[model samples]
Target chain A: MKSWLTTTDHKRIALLYLGTMTLFFTLGGLVATVIRVELATAASDLVTADTYNRLFTLHGVIMVFFFLIPSIPTFLGNYLLPLMLGAPDLAFPRLNLASWYVFVAGGLLTLTAMVAGGLDTGWTFYTPYSTTFSDSHVILAVLGVFLAGLSSVFTGINFIVTTHRLRAPGLAWLRLPLFVWSLYATSLILVLATPVLAMTLLLVAIERGLHVGIFDPEAGGSPLLFQHFFWFYSHPAVYIMILPGMGVISELVPCFSRNRPFGYGFVAASSLAIAVFGFLVWGHHMFVAGQSYFASVVFSFLSFAVAVPSGVKVFSWLGTMHRGSIWLTTPMIYALGFIALFTIGGGTGLALAMLAVDVHLHDTYFVVAHFHTIMVGGMLMAYLGGLHFWWPKISGRLYSERWGRIAAYTLFIGFLLTFLPQFVLGTQGLPRRTASYPPEFQFLQGLSSAGATILAVGYVLPGVYLLASLVRGRPAGDNPWGATGLEWCTSSPPPPHNFVRPPVVTDDPYDYPRAPQPTITGVGDA
Target chain B: MPEAVREPFADPAHQRDAVALGMWAFLGQEVLFFGVLFVFYTSLRVRHPELFAAFAPRLDWRLATVMTVALLISSFTMALAVRFAFTRARRSLVLALSTTMILGAAFLALKGWEYAHHFEHGETPQIDLAGLGRGPGLATFFGVYFVLTGFHALHVLGGLGALGWLAVAAWRTPASDLRGSPVMAVGLYWHFVDIVWLFLFPALYLAGRLAP
Candidate 1:
């Protein structure tokens, strides 16, 4: 803990995030278990209505802000960015460490708020209710969220500059890897979208503390305006959550498929397109919530526009796999799962964009299912896949392939079982966040609860094997996968400077056939 | 390709250029940060123009005007400091940089006084508005003012604290390489903050169609 406190190293900072985020993920999953358990009985027998509210709120807050948002970016991006960019460290090493401290401070404050009676405003902290109605520690929780947003901004700034200024001598812009491009796009959104969230929360805090009238309808302020500002940041924020994961999938698929990514330029630009279009589609989330009619039209068209680039990516991945010698390794399996699940998530999003349909689906379990598909099935799957793919590079050891394959399959199946019935329940008009529901929806709820148990098992498998492997696994030599990147040119666990001698790139990244077989197993000039 | 003939000055110049371009990119994010608040203020003003005007007079224009000038003068000193320090005039440059920091502190002190004055007069948006007006639009105006000005004030105070630390470092560290660069970079941020207030002054304090 003391070493973690004093370390200026980026890898150590990633470890700090890894330890802290893993704890938050477990706590968040615990709350989710309570939620499923409560709903399993069909009556509010396990907890009261208010307790149920707090449970779901804590689940969303912990999962969205703590788990999903930072899952890929903080842990993986922090470890890999400098290495990929061929820099000694991130451009601002002290600022990088400062971000981790800020993350910990925010996490501590949130835990304090939870223990001191818990915040019931959900992660959104919507006005009027958040300002006047909630009984729990709203201000403290919102303050934690504000700190986290600032931390995200600092990280965004670091990644953007590092990518721009620190590329190796011959690693020109066009030669850069897709994962780096994805982080660059995600960083752009993080820098732009996060600050609006900060100010929106600040307004909420001020309104709660000092009778400010920002979102008070009684005070002639529009509640819809609050929705606008909140979603403006948050809608793009979903891209922030998923873009890095998509990046991981992009890297993993081509490497295991034994082919270069088809249309690298297309995949790279899609990331930026998603980032820009994401900002325009926030009002689609507000379609049923009384946003202006013109705003709704604009959002719908922009949402449709956003789908094109995403579709291009899906096609490009499929194109990459068409004639390639596909290896069904665990990471590749998860990548396949991501393409399928993210498609479903993306398609459902398109369905919700149609205002008439969304009017029926809003606040229903369908919306819940759509996001979980993207966030859990897509983002979490990609993150786990990248974790497996890069574990060799990161830890200099091998996790068990047998357990990894089993866990990946289990997670895929479990995710489907958990979310598929929610679509049915939502279509049949069952609302989300209810402690008790009518008996007509009982069967679907039961299936979901059973599925939740299965998903929990899947989630826990990696934790068990990954930890065990750390102690007992075989050492992974550099470039275990035979992938072509500057990172693989170094030791499996890189040294303090990341490289012994600076690599000068002369070929396209991921050029497999021209590369030597059995994967350049040692550092080039180390 | 003789390594010795690779232009002795070009490498450092390139590094500085990279740093400058990266800093501008960062400043672009800062614009969006303050821009979000400005967007909110603009939309709210459109919703209730009269009420915005009614609350505009209550904001002490005198304080706003003074802070504006202090910030402008600080910008001048910051420019001179960067200009001098870059030319390797270490001593005069440090004094000019410290002058900018002092001016920034004074700006914040005046803002604190203005906030106190508003509090005492019961002119805060929700607290004491009976005599001011009864419309909900008026309440919305005060809310926008508080959010924008209050956020701006926080940035001012933060900038002053950072500038203070930079000043201490300037005095202690030898006025060597990266010295002028750090100050110049910080000056860019400070000037940007002032530019935000330049827009804010007319928007908040002089918003209404008053007799000039």
Candidate 2:
């Protein structure tokens, strides 16, 4: 256990992140369950307004900062990046372990805030409210988030350096897997955007601590400035959450469909496109918060424009599926679900981007429903699919395929039942962050709550079966899924150095039949 | 030199190149980190030119100039240390690194003095200057001032630690690995911290100063 704790192996660090993030995911899920139960009724009987606020805030904070952002990139990316790139390990191995410890430290600090008192500011931590109005543990929470941002910075630096400096000799840029491309793009955003968030949070800390007027209105500071800085980081941060999931699907879709992505160049380019354009559309979030009309119009246009790249990706996936040996495996099921749900999420996002529509939907449950589809429906499905797809490669064991499919389908159904009604409630003018709603909205709210229970089951089933598989499941060979990547060119649960010998790539990535097995130059033979 | 080539890389040169590239990538992120603050400071200045002008006089540009020179000299000494590492000149490398640390400490000392003076005059983020009204704008100017410089000072402190570590390693290690990637990596970071100050010095101290 101490060896596992101190190991600098990228694979071990990946497992550490996996175990830690899963704990945070479960905690976030439990908080959401409480929120659903409280909203099940028409009144605030389940918890007080204050507790509800804390519950939801904690839910958002944990899910976004601790779970989704670190979900794919930190775990899967850390494990698979070196394998995919044919490198022994990340550029800075010890620093990689340090990042994990830093992440845990940040998590502990935030948890301490929850224990001491709860932060009531929403996860966005909008200014004036976070800076002046709230009387909770805002400072500790902000500090926690700042530290988490530091961890992200380290991860980003590791990835960018590893990718740029460590690719195998023959793995040219075009031949790189779409997952690597997506990760590289995601790292760019992580490196550039997270610091702005760190600084903005620091400003919030200073404002709160010093009673300075940096964000408070009475001090002539523009609250809009806070939004600008926060969204500058956070708007791109949404990509940080989903772009890696896109990377996961990029791998899963081709492998399950038995074909390469339809437009490989377009698919790879779209990730970069999304990252670049993601930064430009942050003002759309501030349109209803009193930004200039012209700025809103510009942001609205950019928001719509950014959808084109995502649409390209969605079409590329469908095109990959056309006329192929499509296998409806568990991972494939989740990939299909991601495509459908992310489309709905992206479409609703367009509506929200429209200046007029956003005026109506801003601060409404519609926004909540839209993002949940993207985050939970879109990103989480892809996360589960990637986990299932790579399970053999990671653990060298096979989970029950039958159970995996059941969980995937159940999660899709439960997710739809959960969030679909929120769209209706939102369209009917139910504002978000409210503890109580009118009696009429209770039916849909109750339905959403019931769906949450099912969703919880769907989530728990995989944890049980996956853990069971570790001990009792069949031993998987190196390439269980018959996928094409450098990662499959080695033994299962690969050796400490990953490759027994350095892998020399001789063919393009994802070449199902024609690609040659990578030549392993034996140790000291390079 | 053999130890300098860590696993994964086949040769010492490759390891050096990779480490240098990694440091450059990290520096890119550092640019954006300070870039956001510059954006915020610029927007605020554009919004209230008169208030920033009023607050600009409160900063002692002479002390800031001294600190700027100290930082510039530190960057030069850091470059010299990296150059000496290439030549495997252990004594020169150690001398250059220690010089960089001393200059860095000097800059920090001057910054500490400036912060102390501000506190003595009640020119804090919480309080307005003596003659300047307790307007949010004035408070915001000082708020931005303290936060920007405070964060930069933290970076300098971090750089000093790195320089000190490199100095000790240079003094103790065999000549081969001493002239390798570690010296260059730390040099890149020190240079980056110096660059951030170059921006901060002009943006904070010189901007909006009335001529003569």
Candidate 3:
């Protein structure tokens, strides 16, 4: 534990992040439970309107800032990046350690803000409400997010450098894993998107404290300008959440199918395409909010353009699964679930891309369902699958495959039951964020609440089994799945320096059939 | 596999490449950071042209213009310090870094004074935009200007502290030695801060200068 706190090792730092993020995800999940319980009835019986508002804000803030943003990149990417590149450690291990400290400090600040009369403004903190109206701890909450933004920027810098400078001698650009390529793209968005959020929030703080009136609608400030600034970062942030999930999917699908990822170049380029196109489409969020017609058209067009690359990725993943040796492992079940659910999410996103449709669905449960489908159902499944797939490597032991399979199926079923109804409710003119709704929407909300309960069980099961693995499960040898990445080419829980000597990659990742497995004896057996 | 592995590189070339690439990525982010504010200012100013222009005259243009020049001079001194370190001129590098830090400090001090003055007279655009439509539109302009420029001010202060630390480090360890390579990274950061100010100049100070 002491080593966990002060260690400069990237792998250890990754563990530290994973531990904290898991706790935070659960905390966010508890807030979600409250949200679900409130929605179970048509009236606001569970909590008052103010409590409800703060609950959703806390859930969004904790989940988005604390959980989703760092889940894949910091926890998975940080562990795998240096190894895949065959470097001893990150460009600066001390900086890597410092980033963890910054993350924790930021987390503490946020938790402190939560305990000291929680912020009522939504995660977006839309203008005058946040700047002029809110009497809660808006300044402290924004400061927490601002500090977290710095940690994100540093992580981006670390990854960009490591990917460029630390690849093994023969690990040419094309030879890199599709996962690495996707993470590289994700890091670009992180670096570009987060600083804007920092500045935007800093402005909010100034407005709230110094009476600068940047977002105060009554003070000659355009609240819409605040939205523009906030969404400019946040819209790309959605990609920041999913791109690493895409990275994980890139690894999972190919491994489970025992094939080189079909159209690797396409999948890789699509990740980059998503990052670039992400910036242009933020105005889609502002479509119903009185943006200029020109801006609206531009955003609509870019939103469609972004979907093309995403479509290419969906095609590529399916293409990889074409007539390959498909293994129905627990990880594979989650991957398949990701494909189906993410498609639903992505399709709804395209619907919202249209100006007419977006005007109708803008603040409805449809938008809520679309994001949850993509981010939670899609990205969370990918994260869980990756966690299961990499569990052997991370914990040096294998979780119960039987339990893993049940959790995956339960999560998929539970997720669909929960959010699918929200789509119907949204289209039926049900607005989101209300503590109470029309009585007609009550039944669907009840069903969604029931699903949420199942989903919570699904989420908790893995936590229990994964912990059980630590104490009783058989030791996993290096390269547990017979994978081809450099991470698999090292020990399960890799040495402090990551590499015993330096690794030199000689083949492309996922070249399963023809690729020579390194004939090391203790490769996958306990 | 572990037994087959060898030393990846002979020297620290990998480390150098990593730092260089990392620096470029950070600079790219800096562009986006300033770009968001630029876009916001451009959009709002275009929408409320007269209101944006009206508040510009009330601002202390002289103080803003002076700080811009101070920041520009600081950039030159910072570049010279980088040059001195590269040429192994230990004494000159330390001296140049100190001068650059001092210049940076002066810029922040002036900004602090300007902010205090604005706060005292209640000349803030948020409250004083009566010439605009009403309070809201005028408030938006001042809100953006204050947020954008105020955020930039924080960066300036942070840069001063970083430069001061570098200057003190050079004094302790002589910049000619191989120990001073980290200073180049610090120099890149200082220059980046100065460049942000370069953009801030036209955006904040010159918004109303082009009125017909």
Runs with alpha carbons beyond 4 Å of true place in candidate 3: A515-526, B1-13, B51-69, B112-122, B125-148, B174-176, B202-212
| Model 1, runs deviating above 4 Å | A518-526, B1-22, B60-63, B127-140, B210-212
User: For candidate 1, lDDT tens digit of each residue in A341-361?
Assistant: 999999998988987899999
Cα lDDT tens digits for candidate 2, A368-473: 9999999999999999999998898899988888898899999999999999999998888899998988999999999999999989999999999999999998
Looking at chain B only, the TM-scores across the models are: 0.84, 0.92, 0.83
How well is each residue in B1-212 modelled by candidate 3, as lDDT tens digits?
00111133235444445555777788888887777677767766776677768776667778878988888888888888878866767789878888887888888889888878876876564554344335554456666777777768877777777777776666676433433345666778778887887777777677787878
What's the TM for model 2? 0.96
Ranking by DockQ: 2, 3, 1
| Native contacts present in each candidate (fraction) | 0.39, 0.62, 0.63
Q: Assess the local accuracy of residue A299 in candidate 2 as a C-alpha lDDT between 0 and 100.
A: 93
lDDT per residue, candidate 3, A140-197, as tens digits?
Answer: 9999998898899999888887787778889999998888898999999999999899
Worst lDDT run of 10 residues, candidate 2 chain A, spans A517-526
Which residue pairs overlap in candidate 1's backbone?
A: none
After best superposition, candidate 3 residue A313: deviation in angstroms?
1.5
TM-score of each: 0.95, 0.96, 0.93
